[model samples]
Target: MGYLICILLYIAGIIIYGIVMGKKKVKTSDDFVVAGRQLPFMILIGTLLASWCGGGGITGSASVVYLYGPVVGTLHFAGAPIGMLLLYFISSKVRSSTKITVPEVFAARYGDGASIIAVICIMLAYVGLCATQIKAAGNIISLITGMDANLATVLSAVGILLLTVSGGMISVAYTDAVSALLMVGGFLLAIPLLIGRAGGWSEAMAAIPAERLTGTGGLGVIAILGYMIPTISLLLGDQNMMQRFASAKSAEEAKKSNLGLFAAEITVCVLIILMCTIGIALFPSLDVPSNIIFSLAVNYLPFVLGAIVLVACVAFIVTTADSYLLSAATNVTYDVWGKYLNKNADDKQKIHFMRITILVLTVLAVVLTLFFPTILSLQMTAYTMYGAAITPALLFALFSKKVTKAGGIAGILTGGVVTVVWTMVLNSPYGIASAIVAVPAAVVVILLVSALTGFKGEETYRRLYENSKS
Candidate 1:
């Protein structure tokens, strides 16, 4: 009952926030979509962290920490930071570019055909990413409150939908920062209490599995790196991250936000690792791996603190759902509808189209929850497809002057097709990281194709590129 009350209050608070942000009278496509390109550093940093913190950052990381112990947890956390730093480099480029969205970068660099491919990859990939959070929320609510699984699932879905549709990105960014703060505070405050309850550090250490406790991820260094490569690659191309980059008030603001995000990632990941380590020592036999973090909070903390932490987790997931839905909506409206459906549509009509796309994407995300049985069972192909296909070309184009449109196109297609076939179709041979394999494969194709075709940059991009250098 306490958990349910906390969750309901949180939902009410979010809806009210939505109503407020929507009242601003969106005037331009930039106004409706990216808040007129005026997001400051603090909010950008917060929104970026909030989007990633989701069920996976708290619950999933905690769960993995508890089961695999500190070493593997540390490795995974360390691996994720690589993606953040990569984003730092990529954002420096992406933020300065004359592009509005990922596909715009594609079209600006390659052509219309490339833009279409970019849109397809982002839409397909983002839903799977969003669904993972939905599944996590369903599992979290079901475990903590002892509600009927089906009822919990539907209720959680509605919560995500309401929050997502509320004010779109504007709502998502501000609310996410608030949620991230709460989640950090909740975890930090609860840790000592949890540790005291578990007896002491030595006792907690005694409780964990030996293999899970130490060395190159117990799953081997190669295997762990395999899982991380794609995420690392994603720093360059992930729309969620890129949109935030574009949303920053300036290129320097974007770079600063990425730096701050790195700090938050380290701090929050450590907090979560501690909670998970402590939970491992405190609990009895654990059944669901994903439920470990929430289970620990419910089992140990006093009602007030537990409820605060519970809301934090819910906020994380809710903000993630909203962020993803907004990103997916942009791909359609900006990349597809605004460009093709009504190329000459005014800012007002484009804003209208974006709002409709947000609602449509949210509906689809809700419906998607019905199919996947487990949160982890929800396809990560969304991650792989976009990360593998679009990320490589974008990163290289930013760093290497030699990269041509032909190379960019070759890389996008090669990365996209090979990653899908390797991870999904051919089963990612030899257990290599799909990204390790995917990036090099795309790079090879890009190099080969560019060499064959003698591609060059267009005048619009050339002028922008020259201006930036000048």
Candidate 2:
């Protein structure tokens, strides 16, 4: 009952924060979608850190490390920080393009067909990511109250939807800032308590299997690549990160935030790895190893400290779910609806459409969560699909001037189609990640098609690209 109260208080607090943030002056679609493009470096860093250190980080990575051992699993969490560091080079470029979403970038560089395809890929990837967060929320709720998992899922979804529907990115950014502080503090305080309760690091290490302690964790090189590459790929072109970059107040702040984000992400990765490693050691025989981190926070720590960590976990899940939902819905509103359905729609109309889209998306995410077998599998599938399908075209379009429209469109189609077929139709082809095949395939098609076309639009695109950089 005490645990339930703590969770309720946290939910109530987010509700209040959402309502307050939503009241901020919002008169334009730009404001709703990108926080009026006025977010400073600090807020940008918070939201970026909060959004990425989410379901995939907490439950999904924890589950992988717990089951397969930390060596291979750490790579899953490590890729994001590495990606952040790499992003430092491009963050200013992304912001300088003055695009609200990756699709906007696509449409600007590649054309409407490419933009539409990018939207499809974003929807496929982000909705699954939103669903993963919902799954983590449900798992957290069920672990604490022993509630029916379905009921918990519905309740968690409603809470997330409520907060998200209120104020798009404006609310998301502010609340995510608060969530970042809570999450970092909660984890910092909880890990030591957990370590102490688990009978110290030495005992915990003894409880873990000898083989699990090795760097390879008994997994093959190919298997580790499967984990590492997709995460790196997703980070390179993640729409949520791109959207946050677009929201920055200036190009310098946009680039600078990556440095802070990299630092925060490194801190989060180490903490999660430690907590999860300790969790697996303490609860080796639990039925659901994925929930080990949450379980340790709830069942092993002191009640007040446990409650803080639980709320922190909730913040992680909710912030991520809402961020992805907003990103995907933004694509639908601007890239699809604003582009095709209502090209002349005003700010008010677009905002209304975005809210309705959020509701619709929440429902879709709920369904996906109910069907997916595990959060880790779903998370990886979503990451690989986006990374393979979209990142190749995105990176090529952003960095290279020689890419032709024909080549760009073909690359988007091939990458997205191949990832879906590889995962859904062919069962991932010898257990390798779809990106291994899809990204290279997309890149090859892009190069071959562009070369055949003699870089048809190179001079024109180069001018536009140079202007964005300036």
Which candidate gets the maximum lDDT versus the true structure? Answer: 2
Write candidate 1's Cα lDDT for 285-353 as tens digits. Answer: 688766777887788999899988888988888888777888888889888887888889987677677
Error of 2 at 28 (Å): 1.4
Residue-pair clash count for candidate 2:
0
Cα RMSD (angstroms) for every candidate in the order listed: 2.4, 1.7
TM-score, structure 2 vs. true: 0.97
Per-residue alpha-carbon lDDT of candidate 2 for residues 39-121, written as tens digits (9 for 90 to 100):
97888999998888888888888887888777777777878888888889888888887567888777877888888988988
> C-alpha displacement of 332 in model 1, angstroms?
0.5
Error of model 2, residue 275, in angstroms = 0.3
TM-score of each: 0.93, 0.97
Model 1, residue pairs in steric clash: none
TM-score of candidate 1 to 2 decimals? 0.93
